[model samples]
Target: MRAAVVISPLASAVLAGCVVSQTQGGAEHLAAPDGAVYEGVDTRLLDGELVNFVVAMRGARGPDDVTAYAECAAAQYALIRGYGFARQVRTTVDEKNGAWTGDAVYTISPALPRGTRTIDAEVVVAACRENGIPTV
Candidate 1:
């Protein structure tokens, strides 16, 4: 069974100054909770199985939303490449006056990382789908 991803009230609460998250491509495109438009996930393949992912939500989205969106994107992207697992190398999340973004670098592999906050790609993809987040 796959775990479900739930958006917390605090994460979903968007003020007039903030844009809300919305569906796109069968999933959310990093939309702002306040209904402001934002960028979708951008997955950049790097050397030796590494990937750089960027997800942007407009209108001062929350940090949790940023992380959730990024994770969902990573899982989908990994599956798209026929991978079974992924490990986060680093992540930088920022929320400014009108934007919340998650910039992450990860390594995809057939097995999970020995340590650290590694993630199982298929499991995550399933979770995302269960939560209505689109997978690649």
Candidate 2:
């Protein structure tokens, strides 16, 4: 009976972890993909095909985590807006108040933007999935 009880709690813990979603944490100011908390933003509306979304996350996150999360959001946003690609304009990652934040500008277009850091819709989506990163 004791063994059975121990096994029951262990199974519950494992199941609990499995149930956590990709976009579960949003305790920050602006939410991002994965458990990255949204810190804040400075997004703007430029033209119909060009948009910039500056986002942040609250945590002891690294530059890679913040950038990847921002890219994931940008890529997903493009897809949601009926665009197939996003051209990365600039990315600024900083640490503030012990929180890691990233500011990125992406140009949404029906086709890939003319940039080396441009993100392809299908490619980014697949990368996010494979890496367990969440998308907007």
Candidate 3:
């Protein structure tokens, strides 16, 4: 009976590990080509010439986990930009295991260009002291 119990738990653990491995693998495949993952941003007109934007980050393990790391990076980016811009925004982050995620909503004035206005935004997540910003 004791052996059976041990074997049962071991089997369960192995199954769990397999599930996690599969999930992680799938996430890696879905990861952005540049290795920089990005979630869709929902944009709304808060006022004339003003817009409210919601950015979300998702990953494997769990959407919440992916969000957590993303939020931290986002906050740092916002702070580097300026408080004026950061204050006009709200952020949410979630994480699970090795996965990370983040979400934010904010308002911007003066409006951007008609098309997509890509700004230079990058964050350092490790201590390797390497830059991940892509040159446009």
Candidate 4:
């Protein structure tokens, strides 16, 4: 002789909920394949010819995306200030709650700055616009 076991409908529903909830609140669920979503840029003049840019975004693949956003802002800011070039000083990137932020600094000059990371303001701004990154 054999005994048969049965699960009630209510118990089955509770078991299903437990399995589904295990995959929630993970980084993979927050990431998007369509690419990063640019948020905004904030440019501040720290000193004469020295500018600081704070940029934020979502769905960034890594720190590179955040850095690029900050660089784009610095380039546009240089042009707005009547400068033709900018040299990257440094950039600090951070991620929290699936949002990325970059704090970058650059020096603007009318002449091409003496650095390997120098950027032509006009060229950078054009690229930024093409790439759909916001600038200040």
Candidate 5:
């Protein structure tokens, strides 16, 4: 003989709540609690294919936010120059008084740049727009 078990409605509701909370909380969440303010992006052409991007913003969670801003600028710049890809050379980030700045250098090329940090101009620009980050 086997015994049957049953769950009450209240118990099932509590179990569903636990699942909901678990899905809502995790390390992948990086959005700012308050709204972020994007100051602007300054772009400079350093050489034939090398470019510099300076981005400023407020309410950044960390360096990653500023870095993304620079990347967005580079991606749009590459697309505007009729290039399909960009390779990140370097990025420097600083924060002061709740304001953040990122200085980044990238090389734009018609082909995929020779680097591990290469970005597809179209894809990155689309993602930036989806994330509410402005592009150059």
Candidate 6:
């Protein structure tokens, strides 16, 4: 009976390990593909009246297939603008180590004239679909 108990615990531990390993492996595999990750958002005011917005994102892709990364960056910017928070957007994308990092900036004005407010936006990043399905 003691041997049976020991075996059961050992089996459970092995199963747990397998599960963990698979989960981590899956994440790594997913991250390996050319894609992007939304880091965070920052907002500020320019000239005390013009609202400024900045979104931070990271993307990765190979040399030949940069279109995916570009699309990803555009999607990120559009997603934020869709929220109706900013008036206009100025975006910048940087690529490094087979990865692309992007920053999107915009502006928001308050109701009162001469009043500027900066809003830091946060967005979730997900993998693009094969059929061009919206991931946001």
Model number with the top lDDT: 5
Off by over 4 Å in 2: 1-43
Report the Cα lDDT for residue 40, model 4.
85
**How do the residues 56-82 of candidate 5 rate in per-residue lDDT, one tens digit apiece?**
999887776677778778889999999
Q: What lDDT does model 6 reach? A: 0.32
- Highest TM-score among the candidates is held by which one? 5
Candidate 1 clash figure, as a count: 12
Q: Candidate 5: minimum summed lDDT over ten consecutive residues — where?
A: 19-28
The predicted structure with the larger TM-score, 2 or 3, is 2
RMSD (Cα, Å) for all candidates, in order, is 9.1, 13.9, 17.0, 20.6, 14.1, 18.3
The clash number for model 6 is 1
lDDT of 6 by residue, 1-136 (tens): 3221111111222334431112211111222243555554454545543333443444444321222233233334434544322232444555666444444444433321121222212211234333121222
List the candidates' TM-scores in order.
0.66, 0.63, 0.29, 0.72, 0.76, 0.31
lDDT of 1 by residue, 1-136 (tens): 8444333221232222233444421123333245545478888888878999898876534565566667767777877888877766777888777677889888887765554445677666655554444443
Q: Candidate 1 overall Cα lDDT vs. reference?
A: 0.61
The 0-to-1 C-alpha lDDT of every candidate, in the order given, reads 0.61, 0.58, 0.31, 0.67, 0.71, 0.32
- Residue 124 CA error for candidate 4 (Å)? 0.9
Regions of candidate 6 where Cα sits further than 4 Å from its true position? 1-35, 60-85, 110-136
Candidate 1 local Cα displacement, residue 77, angstroms: 1.2
Q: Give the runs in model 4 whose Cα sits over 4 Å from its true position.
A: 1-35
Point out the higher-scoring one by TM-score: 3 or 4: 4
Q: What digit string (tens of lDDT, one per residue) describes model 4 on residues 43-102?
A: 788999999899889988777667767777887888888998888888898999999998
Query: RMSD of model 2, in Å?
Result: 13.9
